[model samples]
Target: MTTTLQINGRPVAVTAEDDTPLLWVLRGELRMNGTKFGCGKALCGACTVMLDGEAVRSCATPLAAVQGRAVSTIEGVKGPEIDALRRAWTELDVVQCGYCQSGQLMSACALLRHTPKPSDADIDAAMSGNICRCGTYPRIRAAIHLAAGDDRR
Candidate 1:
């Protein structure tokens, strides 16, 4: 089937079966590799992407489900919150090994978009789904707090 999705504010078309995972469509068919594949079961947020402004695991999401919907990957994430998050991630050294950073960033972006100023509990709840095998949860939470303009020093 031919599916057209609004990705990162641009319309993209791909041909695949309805059951084809959105991750493969983004990585293989569309050649957008920023979204990683950790666990295909959606338990891992490595494949997280914003679907209509909410983070969804692309590895388990079907291409057909995203048709006509806005899907924002790490490559597509933008705006002031994203900028702040990126800066915080960089300045605070949030990445270690870098495999899960994309998903972490995507999840963080969604959290910031909705919460703006999240407390530690909020940050923890928001990021609970994203697994950073590097064990950077502390740094990740700090980055989210930093991005929210919270003084974590």
Candidate 2:
């Protein structure tokens, strides 16, 4: 099947099976590797991407579901929220293994977009699905807060 999706900001047409995971389309067909594959079960946020400005797991999202919809991967994400996240992430040394940072950033970007000033509880709830084996949760939280100009740390 051929599906045309608005990736980042440009329209991209890709050919794949209807049920093929969006992850494969991005990584395999499109040669975009920013989104990682961790569990392939959608349990991990490593495959997270923005679908119309909302974070969705590409591993579980099928090609048919994203046809003609806007999809933003780590490679294409930009703007104030993402810029703040990148700065805070780097300034706070939020990355350890670096496998999950893209997913974490994507999720965090969504959180900031929805809640410009999120509480600790909100951060926890929004980031609960993303797992960091390196145990950088504290730094991640601090980075989010910093990105939001909270400075609660």
Q: Judge candidate 1 at residue 133 and give its lDDT.
A: 89
Clashing residue pairs in all predictions, respectively, total 0, 0
TM-score per candidate = 0.98, 0.98
lDDT of candidate 1 over 55-74, digit per residue (tens): 99999998879987999999
Model 2: residues with Cα > 4 Å off, grouped in runs: none
Cα-based lDDT at residue 62, candidate 2: 93
User: Which residue pairs collide in model 1, if any?
Assistant: none
**Candidate 1 accuracy as lDDT:** 0.92
